[model samples]
Target chain A: MIPDKAKELQERNLKYAQIIQDAMSGKREDMEKRIKELNLASTPKEVIHSETSIKLYRFIPVKKKLHKTPLLIVPSLILRYYIMDLLKGHSLIEHLVESGIDTYLIDWGIPGDEHGHLTFDYYIDKFLKRAVRKVSRSTGVEKINILGQCLGGTIGVVYTSLYQEEINKLVCLTTPVEFEDAGLLSVWTDRKTFNIDKVVETFGNTIPADFIHACFQFLDVKATVERYKKLYNNVLDENFLYYYKALDQWINDKIPFPGEVFRKFIRDLYQENLLVKGKFTINEKVADLKNITCPLLNIVAKFDHVFPEKSAKALNSFVSGPVDYHIISAGHVTLVVLFPQREETFKLISDFLKK
Target chain B: MFMDPAQFGKNFMDPTEFNKQFYGQMEQVFIEKMNEMIKNPAFLSSISKGVETGLDGKKKSDDLIKKYLEKMNMPTREDTSKILQYLQKIETKILDLEDKIEDLSDDLKNLKKEYGKSRKTEKKK
Candidate 1:
């Protein structure tokens, strides 16, 4: 009788397993089809004025009037800049433009073997600083409003700290100032376990896609799985599929972080927690947060799993600027994209910059 | 257990009485759980913290619910529980692997030291 009961349980379990497997396979097929459709549908627009090194994609403001200072958007190195300007309705870039803000976004080109030796100082001092100078010179404005998202936010903060005179206003979205408080990513990147030298040596300027994917997976393993399942179920709708594809493309669009820059980032920020401790040194000169004296606006996602509120809030203590910090009731991406008009986040940012 | 309509009518002519009896049992269960929560300081603290953090959004609420369910000694949802268990196992495995790597590193260091000593002796000879 006991053997019969055990066999019955085994059969039931096997049936359940089969059901899950079928569901997963169906979901995968739907997702792949949707992805292919999206790739076909997407129209890649070329920049009106393209430079040799960086391509400038311009999205003119919907309203004829422009804000006093032209806003420059800097997205993270891990993902594409289009995530900020995803779709017309859900796009932060569109909303900003419609609200009469002059915006220009920098698309950090994918790094090559030549960029392997590029250090953090090069990014902050050379690329970003040079970009700011060029923009300022072109616009004939002494100072330009600068905004950075994710890792770009970190770079923005570093830039602002070092060269506050060049920046009129600074805004950071979901930026991590205190690396020690940055949760799993911080712990994982710490010196003891991370052999960055081997990775840089092997891959040159580019870190493997698997490594980046693994870091994101570690953030929320269940959500990562469930998100695709949900996407699969909703793949029939063209609009939903477009949004999913845009998001998927942006998510999978991993850029090779210049090895030397990455090395400095991990060593200075994660290993030493130098930014918050006020010990970060740039070009043998200390990059002190106290040096930043611009009007600062720091927007943090209340429910950000990747960059926690604590990590973002650490900037409050470090910066000597006229700072205003607001916690938006959205996740990292939604904090910028969703409810672009209704949410007080956009209005607050606009008002700050306008002043 | 079939009751005659006349007998049933006679037993409880009022619907209020039946409802009172039904809800009285539910009230007792609710109070018992509440009492259990209050008695345990850790459970109480966790519940309060959960409520505090629950204000963030859906993700925070879900996390709070999961934590609350664990604290209440209730069965967790299958997917959530499975993922949590898998993560715990992975974390443990990673720690173990790191320990082994550290040990191997130490062994290598000692081996290198011994080789250096042997080479010095060979040079002296």
Candidate 2:
């Protein structure tokens, strides 16, 4: 090796040795304490409606000139609602509220034993519908806008299809519509390979959060390993450390997907691909995507492993309204977590809602 | 600009760089192989079978416990779950009542506004 290269290597080695020495000096203990005290989901909000395990929150607006039509954000049932309002400054909810969009969120709280019997129909009809009605009634507007992410987006699409007249605009963030080519999840939930009924029967009420976490972790073990590597490399970066710890906490904070809802979601959407086929039903009402005539904004992640871009973009072909389709260069989680992509996505959503 | 193969190899022979490249390739290969294995039909079937067998054993043991608890006149998970379900049903009924009452109240307010508007219109005439 060249002399300069050798010297650079020597310095890097010394740096590593110092980092190890710091680790031995209980800097890690301080990090652990700081992580424990890390405040997340810090945006101020009030519970506007509560039923069973679900709570609908209306964020206290920071701006005076609010939009006429209120915006309701629906997150995946399996994940916490805080992913949207993750940090005070770096939050989608905060951005929307600051932009003067009256915002509401459906927090699908940790399900209990009794919540296992809760079906998809109940979630769509009762939980989502009630949340929408509350937002609409409270805002005194007949029409409202909805922004849903992942599985929540699927629920929003169905809800908008059933109640298109009451929806002014619909935004879907990386929502899988054509599950036939959705990705590994579709393959894993195949009827021939997997026994959904038996699994539901065994678990009884709600699928444990750990089981879901394990499955997701199993999806990309290399990615999980690389995440730790990144965290290690950025140990000295306070900003990076804060964001990483916050995201790490959110990812680990898992919640059970109610049993019957899981069964139906896998069977109908993942296995059968019913929603795009216009055969999926909620409470005896067919949720045909063509019924969604409101202006639709579908944002899909180009590099999403969970829901492939093609699968998410399939919403555009079905919706009757004019579609504003965008495929951003980001992964499923990174679209919301990362800076540049997150900012772009927020701008797209806020601009769409402003229209 | 000419260089011998041995000298070129030596030039690139840093242990740190070698380790990074080797591990990067290994990670790629591992991920590719694992994804392929996971997508295999036989692999999926095997996993399903393992899960089903494990769950079956658990179910059998849980049944045994339930029987013993019943003999001791103690409530099992089923008993508690049934009661919870009943309470959820009652809660649903109450919510339904609340919804109906809200709708009626809105209608009453609308009727009162219409009546007040008609009386004012008659006075204007």
Candidate 3:
């Protein structure tokens, strides 16, 4: 190697040595105590309806109720709902609630073998519709606005198309609309090579949460390594430690996806790229975007690795009504954790819904 | 441009700035390489192919296990799953019947209320 390169390599080794020394100097007990103090999803809410395994909750009023249309936040079914309200002051739901936005969330309880046959159609037609009706009756509103993130947003897109009259507005966050050239995860789930039927048959009923996490971890091995290294480097900082614990806890706390939903999601959405092509269907009904007349707001994370910004922005072209497309300067996880991005996302949801 | 020895020494002496620059460069290079690897068609295609092959192997192994279990007169996972599915179907049917019964009961009560009101009116006449 060149002389300058050799010198830099030596300096880098020295820096690593110093970093290791500083990292070791932090008190072990202090780190343990801080981690133990990290609690998540402390927001109070009442379960208004429970249909078998699914539950719909109404967050207790924090700010004075001003809005007629209650905003329902759909939980990505594969993951637990509390990531939206991970911690006090850092919560997306809390910020909206305190701002006087009528907010609700669906807790898709962990799927068991009994729920294995519950397809996307069953979820959207039977459960989602019932929840919307429950909210509408209680709030005395004809139509409600829905905010769905990630896979939940994909569900929302389908539901809004199917039941256009029920929804007043649609807000999708980091939702993959056009799957072509999307990201590493998309590439890995290519239909021709991936046997969805075999995987679903083998797993049976519900795919374990650990399986999904492992797959996501494989998407970026380097990022995973860098994240842990950064974690150790900042273990001494109490604030960083708290948020890290909260986020990490939320990521690990996941729900097994209903098997039928998983199969359809992989085959139809990811494999065929049907939603963007306007050929996606549920229960023999065409899920045409033109059928969706509700005002749409597509919130995309610019640096999202799972659903890149280009894939998410495709929503703008499909929607018939006015589409408010907002791009934030954050990655997928940071879109929820970082204060500025989270705050901005919360603000955008409330504002777009009210419009 | 080659840095003189004195300048390099000055940069190294300020450990904080040097560390920041070093890590920044490292992160930039790491991300670029990762992105390149991810976007490579051969890499992605190979991953899918490998996963498919592994899946096929799993399915074959599962089939063999089920065959052995059947020969020993043991209940297999498929057998148990089918039983569970049947039970779930029965449970769902029962729930539906219950809802229908509740609706019929409400209708009967309403009919009785109207009869009572009509009888009272006739008695007054």
TM per candidate comes to: 0.63, 0.88, 0.78
Which of the predicted structures, 1 or 3, would earn the higher lDDT when compared with the native? 3
lDDT of 3 by residue, A83-181 (tens): 788888888888778777788888888688778778988888877877887788679888999988888888888899888898999999888878888
lDDT of 2 by residue, A189-210 (tens): 8898778888789888888776
User: What ordering of candidates by TM-score runs from best to worst?
Assistant: 2, 3, 1
Task: Extract clashing residue pairs from model 2.
Answer: none
Task: Tell me the spans in candidate 1 whose CA falls farther than 4 Å from its real position.
Answer: A1-53, A56-58, A339-342, B1-125
What's the alpha carbon RMSD for model 1? 20.9
Top candidate when judged by lDDT against the true structure: 2
True contacts kept of 1: 0.00
Clashing pairs in 3: none
- Alpha carbon deviation, residue B43, candidate 2 (Å): 1.6
* Deviation (Å) of A138 in candidate 2: 0.6
**DockQ each:** 0.01, 0.44, 0.29
Q: In model 3, which runs have C-alpha deviations exceeding 4 angstroms?
A: A1-37, A63-66, A218-222, B1-35, B64-75, B90-125
